[model samples]
Target: MILKLISRSKQLVPHSPVRILSLYAVLALLLFSAVLLVGLMPADAHAARILEPKQISGAFPTLAASFNPHEQVGHDQMENMDHGHDSGLSVSTALFYTARIVYYTALLMAAGMMLWFSGIRSGSDEQRKRMQQWSLPMMRALLLASLLYVFANARSLMEGYGGGGPEWLRLFTETNTGQAWLALLILSLLGFAVIKASDTFKLIWALLLLAIESWSGHVAALQSNMNLGIVLDFIHLACAAVWSGGLMILLGLWFVDRKEAGRFAERFTTAAWISMALLIITGAAITLLLLPSLSYLFYTSWGIWLIVKIALVALVIVTGALLRARVRRGELPDGLMLKVDAGLMLVITLIVGVFTYMSPLPDNTPVRFHKMGETRHFTVNITPNEPGTNQFEVKIWLPEQLGEPSEVKLVLHSRDRQQLAPLEVPLAIFEDKSYESFPGFVRTSYHAEQMDIPFPGKWTAELQVVDKSGEKVEESIDFENY
Candidate 1:
């Protein structure tokens, strides 16, 4: 019905200059609106709450007290010790993920045009003109998407780093993500400059742009085999772009002229098979590198999201198979089925964006242990025993006093086999003595003041309890960081 309308409209106004100009103006206005929407989006909620040096120093009293009389650990050190323990699904995170989805979809559309235009021989003059007309709007959308993508990256950085001043500039100049964004911007410009050159050149440029995506993802920092992982990531992204993007272009063709698109559908089907195979291989390689065990698939949020993506991909495959069967039987593929497949692919792409910010497995698990000493029994509980900042708590039970001890102190030693100064955390006695501190009305025990673990790796926690006689009893326990 839409194609019939298009045909009728073209016949009615075949050479109406006013109508063509008005259509182009409307498209330009829409593109401008999209750019404005991204630019005017609100900043993240937490961006305003970034603590200054004084604020950080005041937050952790124990850490500030440890400063030497002549020298103090500066703001940088304190800031490093502070971790963003807030939930991952923030408004800013959601916006960035949405931006990513938009960017990837635009990329596929642009690249898919190249793939489609390159695979088939030139059709009649009318078909060629139609393809060119479609390409112009697609290219414009791609450029707009690239701009939005860069804006999203910058916005995320600004929110994460607190302000859009020197800190944000430093990140842009120093980080891999910044470098990749810069590279993408350059590529986008290059693509625009040579868009009217040749189909081969456009195809090469699109693939290169897609490959650059690897640099900004987890593949760039893979610990086991960084180089191979990045290469595989590039392959995965390229194949995905071709498969998803190609389908989008084919759908556009179906809308424009179903018969012409069907002529090349068989060839695209063959390429799609190869693309799917490569996607599975490369995606599996990257997934194995990330997930420690199969248990994570059901246990971790990242793993569950990954499973959803896998199921969506499977659905796409099934839909593609059904479409191929229809095509083979000389029947036009159902547009609704194709739409469902495209929608699934879109969701899968968005999930990939979300995965970029989420961890593949759980990182924080509290460590608990008990130690029997000569004069004191210590029950230690370390909350969120992760590699970053952590809270350390100890409850000392004095068998003789039948009341709270006068003093409690904690010293941390890095068990890295290198000689280092001990980090002392003075524990203040909780005056309120809540039920958690004295669960049984036996006032012999009091909760020690909590302290933060500023760093990770193997560490030993030495607890010292001073009795009324000024005698100190010490107990040490060793543990590894997450």
Candidate 2:
């Protein structure tokens, strides 16, 4: 069966595989069209994704209000965005994800072709010819995508974190997200220089490119077990690139010559098989890193996108198996199935580009409580304000009148449920500048903190302050756990 493709390459075919690839090209465009439509959904509409998406993936999409899972586009914010402004935001977002999608496709395709051709032990001429024809364009796409991602990402970040920023150039150099963007831009430039380099050089280039992807991803953002997360993300990305990139190059080769392409396809199917195995394995490892809990899969937008990606991947695998079976039986494959397989891979890439940019930590909205008593001010702030174990910080203002309080306690109580027992955590000295006492102020600031929340519900936190005179001034505010 493999011999058929090898022999067929030597013989002339009646038609160009260009039309078939043109079919793939149309499918690719349609895939992008779908991504753009979803990306440009109304601001509030985007906020409700779960039944939604995770991107803006790989770059600037996180800065786009439409795609940032951590910073939701609230109704009030959306209401403020009149149709014109809304349209502009949507367009900005659309460009961000679109460029990223194109970038991923091109980078993987270029790298995959390098590996594909390398499989031909003796076809030095064939390899060199294909590299000359294809490598530069793919690298150019990477260069172009990186530039757009930088511009859009900088713009989005400035809008979010700026008066327009700490400034855009500084933003890239000083921040984690920005540094990663810079790496992408720099690496892509380097990619162009190495297009015609040796197979070993190409392999290194591909690994480096995949590494850039890992840097911006949720796996890299893990507060704990970061090394494991990065490994999982890299392996998963490599497998995906191999599978998708190899298929794309193969289709292009089929357009050139079926028999010659067959030699590569025989090797590629083996690569695809290995890649699929690692894809599943690394995907599971990544899930453990990204998913907060099993229940999140059923309810969160991130979980839903993951579920869809899983289903799409399953479809791709089944289709490929059927097509490979046909090849094994000494029969020709219907080119349409291959196109479908390619199309599905593209869609999976789209899904990944978004969610991979999503926050690994599940929803943790900010929660704060502030109130003034006769002689002191009390406050509590919860970061990522979500259920389960939570960080609690309490601040007290000790006027010259109150002096320093003898003790401060962060006491928590349930207002709506009985199962939740009351919790009291003494905020020990917070020596960090943000929590430290600022000198020369009329009112001294005292900050204390603990991390021990066990659940989420309607609750009340009471700030208890004891004066040196043995009197207690207690202030309480009703707030809910996130």
Clashes found in each candidate (C-alpha, N, C closer than 3 A): 0, 9
Model 1 lDDT, residue 183, Cα: 81
Worst 10 residues of 2 by lDDT: 47-56
* Candidate 2, residue 343: how far the Cα is off, in Å: 0.6
lDDT of 1 by residue, 274-375 (tens): 678667767776665554434557766788888888888899899889888888888776788778878888888788766766766466567797865555
Candidate 2 lDDT, 209-317, residue by residue in tens: 7887776676555433455557667767777778887787667767776764565566566567767866776676566544534455765667888889999989988
Candidate with best TM-score: 1
User: C-alpha displacement of 22 in model 1, angstroms?
Assistant: 50
Worst window of 10 by summed lDDT in candidate 1: 42-51
Best by lDDT: 1
Global fold similarity of model 2 (TM-score): 0.62
